[model samples]
Target: MKADVIDAEHASRVTKVDSLLPEIPVLNADDVQLVGDPELITVSVGDSAGSGLATCRSVPEDSPRSSWQALTEHRLELKLAGPEPVAAISALLDQWEVHLANVARKSDIETAAVIARPSRDTIGSAELLQHGFAPVVGIAVRPAERLATTGPVTTPGVRIRPAELGDLPTAVHLQLELQRYDAQFGMTTMRAGAEEMVTEELRAQLSGEPTMWIAELYGQPLGMVRVQLPDQAFWISSCVNAARVGYLSSLAVAEPARSSGVGTALANHAHQVLEEAGAEVMLLHHALASPQSTPFWYAQGYRPLWTFWQRRPAVR
Candidate 1:
């Protein structure tokens, strides 16, 4: 007999399976087709160790119910599909788990949910501690728009300009200050020494790896932003079909400059530089749990495209 098939839509029926076997590996089976919708495909797990079947489904419209139901009393797995599959699967997994425990009186399986199309290599496992499903991180692509205003509005005595090799000392100081903030927020601090930071950043800048801008108030360096030229591979994959793109990395504003428009100024400069460099799109990553930075970036016109999920299975 042919293996069971699932589409992005019918994948909902397999929520029970997801709740039961959360850690089961999800393989992209783009080759198999489902019977109902030709646009959807069934992912096949051939002789897998897990004792369950999972499929993807598509939901054409926004409705409470969209032609998918769980099969109880059977070991199964399911994966949801949509523009935002991570969030949808998370909600469905929660409901399915609750219903199963309330009715079946048995709970032995570990269910896991992950956001597909992750931007990075691995979503650290720490993301699973506070929530059942890992939060889906977002990436935004900003379009180039002519600036109606002039350069950054700096403090009365503040200065802004491109960082030079001579600014390494000041840059290292600012980088360390940023590192302190990261440590306070339980983020991993860069183990590289100041010399390393300066060397790497300077090398990148000198080689035109990234456009670097610095903010100085009263002749004292305050903050920095680095706008990297678009990678050929990334451009071909994401925006090649549209327009040129760039990636913003290492945007930092000192604590004292938080509300002083320093961050916004640096970002605006980065955007301007990117636009002038023939980049029509820009992307950046932020920790979903980082309250201080997430909202700030959102206010600057970035939106969610994808998220990373993390979990650490108990070592045997």
Candidate 2:
């Protein structure tokens, strides 16, 4: 068989999942074809009722390699619309595993793996890894203005300047360090192949689309920030309301540089950049429970405009 594909529209039971979880979107089986066989079947449960779709694609049984490799190598995504959908989809995935095992055994295929997105309740890496999956990666947002006057005050040093290609590596390293600091609070870890990703991101920044700035002390990189102009629908919405917002995507201070005003200096620099770019406000997202940042942001004038919660089975 070229490939066994099952889509939302084709399966009655799949429709039931969509009905239960309207927020989730059904998968388009065609998109699954990008992965070559022996491929792991990608099953996505979206958070939508009639609006959402759940999809699954099975690899060819007679393929030369193991199915586990196929599943692990490709990106598999699953979204549960709500609490009810999460429970339902979890059960559904278990049922699919049984079905897959039977088919693999009959076709003389050994070593099959199925990876799904963890429910919001997913606890630790051990649990996710046990299920042959990784924890979901989440994006963190923080208001640019929050860092304005929060944290320890430091004497202003060098004036903020536009970042050059020569600063890309340093800026990238700063972002990675901040990410590492974030992982302490159960946030997504940026380790493992992150260096290459950061390098590519820096290259993109250098090419255009966003402006990057760095704050230096005594000729060394102390802190940095990046501001991207409004380009997407959400950004446009923010702008139409004259949100005049700037985003503080990445801000960091070396351990030795802390409490010396590096962060404040950087935020001040970002504010200037945003004002010049016509931004009257700035937006950022940070973990609610973060010790070093949450209070700092609060002190600077950024308040919680939204919240996100996650839960997973206590067992795994």
Candidate 3:
């Protein structure tokens, strides 16, 4: 089943969560598909009170995407367009939980995750928080011009250059260090074999899509930054299509290199590189729980554009 109306065409009962949002949350049931049993993914919106669609996908322990939410494996995507959206969506979520229980044991699915794409309005953001949705991941963006600037950490013996195949070992180590830092804030659990995962992911990223740049001080690899050209998948806000977006996938600085301005240097270098590539905007995601992330990104001219709220409930 799908939402009775597509694109919230007649969602009189629901109001826009963010008026400045580029597009309305019009994802119908057909908007997504799951990897598990087809029977596990069900939709229901036939004349439903809410104009929004509700869908759930159960993630197995081995799922690559499931690593972020260590305690919960259930993912939920929701958007209700109609009058009394909060109340309507609340009820729909309750029903979805029951649906999951019927098909799978509650133990396999502990939490519900939802990605709330960026928007200008606070209604949806606020409502989700009120309903136990905690802001775990944040999408931040800024223009390329604002990011282009004089080097912030230009000191004797500090250099930034493109990453090469030879830098994989240091690159992978830095990436793991970043994950460790984020884990301190509960951004993700330190799962077994995470190092192997990062090694594989970095090797592929270094070889393809993302352009990796390393920061060295006295020939010792202290940090690195990964940048990517705009890929539609990361741009959840359809309205953001007008400009070429350069994505900052990750930035890693060793503990010994933190205060020496290595991060800023890497950031400025990335800005210059992306600008040369004709990028108009820069985007990245961070966790709100990290004290270091909040101030650092803002200082670099990035502001919160979207929030991914999550919830975890015991077996129903």
Candidate 4:
């Protein structure tokens, strides 16, 4: 079935399943469809929707894009829900495996991912693991109201300031360093021309939004973070129930500054800035396996809202 044609009963059932995880907003069925037109599979029992899955295929190599798009050439994002979600997911994967082997070009599609909830981590464990998928990343959220009222938490001798066009070199270098580090974990890829793409992307953000911030320690730039306020965060704001949301796009600390409180200062500053800008909640993504980020974000009061289980080179 086409995503747009999902019936009300199915949508309602999906929402019911989602209610199990109150932290995540119930995505409207209409908005569940990904960028490319997606195909959906509906599991039914006696005329009632028992489960559903929607798959969207994405090909980022078709056009010039941001360096972040280097992760995969062809990708598949799966949206699933149901009462017996595990069984339904297993069946869907079974069918997809066949389709991948018979019709799809195995070498072209690089990743297949499912956006799931941390609350349901064990629900489909066997199925997801059997299919070679691993929980790789998490989308974490923090309430902005509390932070807004809280006093600033700054490290001594560290100063945070808005990034300017003149800081382009430092910003780009830090971002690329982050990309390269993350690439080691497979979530990010440093493709040919990635440096140019990252430079261009950072240049635009620096010159336009005034949303990025740099952390300085004794006059040396050591950390940077890009946060988009509610207005600028509309792209992902709808994913949560908060009427006003903020996004922590990227946060990086130089190797020399690791564990020196630079990251903490940068993040604390982001909370203060975003909250002051009227953000009711803030969200960010982090690689689940990252030793540096997991504990840091948790300490900042962020918890996983959605976990992405992914398998690279889909066919595998």
TM-score of each: 0.55, 0.51, 0.75, 0.82
TM-score result, candidate 1: 0.55
Clash totals for all models, in order? 18, 27, 7, 1
Alpha-carbon local distance difference test for all models: 0.48, 0.47, 0.63, 0.67
For residue 13, what is the lDDT in candidate 2?
Answer: 38
Model 2, CA-based lDDT: 0.47
- RMSD list, candidates in order: 13.8, 10.8, 5.1, 4.4
TM-score-sorted candidate list, best first:
4, 3, 1, 2
Model 3 Cα lDDT, one tens digit per residue, 1-316: 2454634543332234333334443222232335354222223333434432334454455544445663443455454554454455566556655655664445443455454544443445565665556777777777777543663546677798889889999998988888888876656656678778777877887777548999998888899999876653344334343357787888989999886878888888777777777777777778788988779888988877666666545243
lDDT, model 3, position 210: 45
Higher-lDDT candidate among 1 and 4?
4
The numbered model that scores best in lDDT is 4
Query: In model 3, how large is the Cα lDDT of residue 204?
Result: 82
Q: Model 1, range 240-305, lDDT digits (tens) per residue?
A: 123466788668877777777777778877877776777666777565667777788878776554
**Candidate 3 clashing pairs?**
13-82, 13-83, 14-82, 14-83, 18-121, 52-80, 52-81
Residue ranges of candidate 4 with Cα displaced over 4 Å = 1-37, 44-56, 62-66, 69-83, 108-122, 147-150
Q: Which candidate is the best by TM-score?
A: 4
The per-residue C-alpha lDDT of model 4 at residue 181 equals 83
